[model samples]
Target: MAIRPRTAALFAVILVVTLGVVGVIVHNATRSSTSSSGTVTWWLPDWDWDVATTLVRRFESENPSLHVEMVKTTGGTVANKVSVALDAGNTPDLITESIARTKTYIDKGQLADLTSLYDNAMPASDFAPGLTDVLSVDGKTYAVPYRWATNALIYNTDLFAKAGISGPPTTWPEFINDAKKLTTSTVAGTAWPMQGDPSDLTLRFLDFALQGGTTIKNGTPRFTRDSVEQALELIGTSVVEGYASKSSFELDNTGIRDLFLQGRIAMYLGGVFDADRAVGQKFPVGTAIAPGPSGPGVQEGVGWAYIVPKAAKNLDGAKKLASFLGRPENMASLTLTFPARVSAARDAKFRTDVRKAYGEQLSEHSIPAPNDPRWTAMIPFVHDTIQEVALGSKNPQQGAAAIMTEADKNLGPAQ
Candidate 1:
């Protein structure tokens, strides 16, 4: 690569330094906001600026004494930003879109012990059993779920009819067979993101392991080596065996969803967020639970939760706001997400309007991601190794074995 001009280079260096110094300063500011009297700052992953402003306004309206400042952050950078802000004693009152980092924050003592308030403000008895379970560690609840998203088998009805398949596959073998049958030189049956994208790989494996009836243990992710090995092999079979397209590496969430909607692929694995969009576009499609090696009885649960950092300057206010927002009706209207509270999720309107379409597919076989703090830290490493496996640079067995070893070294030996 050609070198940049000296002025440009100096500017770049200064920018980098500025960001780094700011991050360090924010990290050292550890003041949790508790009272409703002062302004409380909140951070959320980037979204429509208008929607964010509305949310902040709603929150402020609910708690008149508390002024709110909501800043948008990126998912990739939110955890690091929070970490830095807390370290510098300048923490926000609350944060969104860092659900995966709750365990890490709790472990670092950067998150508040919300068990008492969580239990009292919104009794565990009130929320969906699974939601409570997903956020609880040992016996303490550290986060509150706000939005839920999960991968489902989205198939093109037109393609399926032509392929002579009656419906979506209920079992992994059948799924593979269907993919093979529907696949043409131009269209494949299903396309899933690869290990290069650890979220994709992890979520897929979580679904596979859930279908296989496995669970994490002592902060260690449990993969039935034999069954999971077969699952990984299946991915290779999809490509090397000629059932799926090698072009999958080029597709992200949008590409995959677009391909499915455009009838380029017969089936795809993706989240429910696409449902509204799909419906809006009037795409003729049907969704079913992801096919498992076993059968339809297996499915997976995926969603995001809310966590209040211990460094928050307004912990009390934040928790109160969280509680109010978590109220069944409020949550149902604000985000239209599957309410973490069972009562809300079970409400007739909620089920018919929100859960019914996606519930059955997720409930039968929903598994939360690994709760270990190490899993979060080591995800990137795992993702890279997965890419190697997908590229035929490493065998799936060897890839997984390497991951296990890295897990032990980085995640502290499974507990």
Candidate 2:
């Protein structure tokens, strides 16, 4: 099931209650020291559970002294689980989560500083340029980036042909016109994930915002800038005019992707992960950089990073597991995501037209999310304001102004 936004206050309360119960159990277990086996516990999301299990077995076979225990978590619950575990002083030695969310752990001083390991074992230069920086906080490394992805406009080639369109649109006006032409009684011209999940909605907004050169500097949002406002206006107009799917507000990424695979949507912004699935389903998928106000737009790239919490019971073993998973060979074998390591990314499997297109976009036009702890705090506000604009509850100008005000309050004064 898709995760929805929650108030920070509620999350804090859950964390406290969960930690109170777990802390005693952990403290008692550790104090007893009942077992001699050196087992490293890990919490990982369900996306690649099987692949991760295989890799963990291999690592254990290579190092008989260590046994890796994999704890499967879901996308919706993993963050809260990890938070409670950390507060209870019983967090898994290693965990995987989005780089953006991982930063919050680092901000709370809950993550291990992996600078020495990164320097001595996995050199920063071996990774995709700027990735180490993305995973770093205040110049200290805390996590190892595992896989990266950038958003792109994935379209149905068959739909384009039926609509008599030559190719994917490269400008906002063309995009809107093409979307209208692709619309039919049976299928939506385009789709957007307008579900209440802040991360989902905010990422979509950032794609357009970045293309317009919008940046959050010193906690002040630049949404009122002409370029940013224009981008929002385009999306607002498309939704209001019925060029986008009417059910967008109810659907998340997975729901939209299912519709795309069923040929119910002509176009949508998605990542490289969907490319293989589209091909596997025999859909004629065509990918292009997102269209901008006047030309090709910029996209944002982010990834999942592996981290060891500061409260982990098996620190050494955790670091070893992280290092093993980051090896070029293991990374290529286990993950379909674009590898964060430059050397692994060079593998022939990533050279396909779709992957190459995403790579080119990442190298040429992509930007990471704003490097600030409060960025996550601002997401829900941004999501809600965008929803208001898209659903016609607020005009684009009003939505932009409201977003700026909310951002200022949530993000605090510029550092």
Candidate 3:
């Protein structure tokens, strides 16, 4: 009507402000409705950041609406960082951590159940057998595994040739005999980690226990049957007979690996990564499955998985990313170790000699760590007992008894 200039000016200002408010409301509403079109924060170890970045880029290319924010964490500190975040109610959308830790989160109800996603995303038979057990608590899956690292016998081919050993040992008897043959004034036949690090000792012991047919029934460590005592006795005898170095009591896994690299240690049960490291250093290395009493022993390994926190703001986006990362090809590109998916290992890129060895051990002989939340807490007792046996303070029988008592006590009744 243009009755007054002041009135007209006031009306225009009101109209502009109202339109701005409406635009803000519409933007917020669109963002809420399209939950998949948002940023998903990911906390991953620094070592895997390169491959993770590549995977993220690919996912983003396919999902233009979603953005991934990669937060790199140091391996030693990531667990603590994740715990703090969870406690503070500030957890990221996704976390790539050891399966053991992931299980802990599941037990504490901190992570979302991915059982439905796992079932819908891939066929049950496509994954490595028993792979999901590590991330499951009370039969509900909480995470999806991507990469794995397992123990394998890494020997020096040059030293084996010098010792006149024809090939890697096929059984425990041969392993002991070969160790004796490989021992010299300069090099020890084989070395194992006997240091204060309970994890190293626990894993090494588990490899033997599993080979002896030890099983964890309802989260309890059962070592009385299946030649479990014989396995412990074998390790003890190796130490007492001087085939293995006494210094192993002071050395950790890394220390043992270093000795092997320097040609001072002839053989060792080490991670699959050791093969890659040896090859990288131009050292003549040979890989084999750990010898058991009867044949190839069950290998013990730990893996990393992708988990979404219960408090995640971008639940749908996080689930989408988790499923994307689980894709066989994507997982294969992320780690040198065996991929969790069977199809991923069948990819051409995993056909190298080292990868082949790892794949064989994982598929045929691998046993993941016990899916007990108390397993971590029980490592110290197991480690101490093994050290006691190795140092001649106790025999294998006594050591076994002590381990059972301690494990049972700490593990409680088991849920």
Query: Highest lDDT among the candidates is held by which one?
Result: 3
lDDT of each: 0.67, 0.79, 0.81
**Model 3: runs farther than 4 Å from truth?**
1-37, 119-121, 218-220, 225-228, 412-415
**Model 2, runs deviating above 4 Å:** 1-37, 216-224, 370-373, 413-415
Measured by TM-score, the strongest candidate is 3
Estimated TM-score for each candidate: 0.81, 0.83, 0.87
Q: What is the number of backbone collisions in each predicted candidate, taken in the order shown?
A: 30, 0, 0
Ranking 1 against 3 by TM-score, winner: 3
Measured with C-alpha atoms, the lDDT of residue 93 in candidate 2 is 88
Q: How would the candidate models be sorted by lDDT, starting from the highest?
A: 3, 2, 1
Q: lDDT tens digits, residues 79-180, model 2?
A: 788878877877788998877677667768899988877755578888775777766767788898888778888999998998899999988889889999
- Tens-digit lDDT track of model 1 for 1-415: 7667997889999999999998877766533323334676677767524555776687778778888777888866876787788667677887775455566666676777667666565777775436666566678877778665566677777889988999888888898889999988888877767624567766675566555535565434655555545656667557666667677778767777787777777887766666556767877777777776667644445556667777777788878767766776655554544655555666554454223546665554554556677666676776666567667888878876876677667755543
* Per-residue error (Å), model 1, residue 144: 1.8
**Which candidate would rank higher by lDDT, 2 or 3?**
3
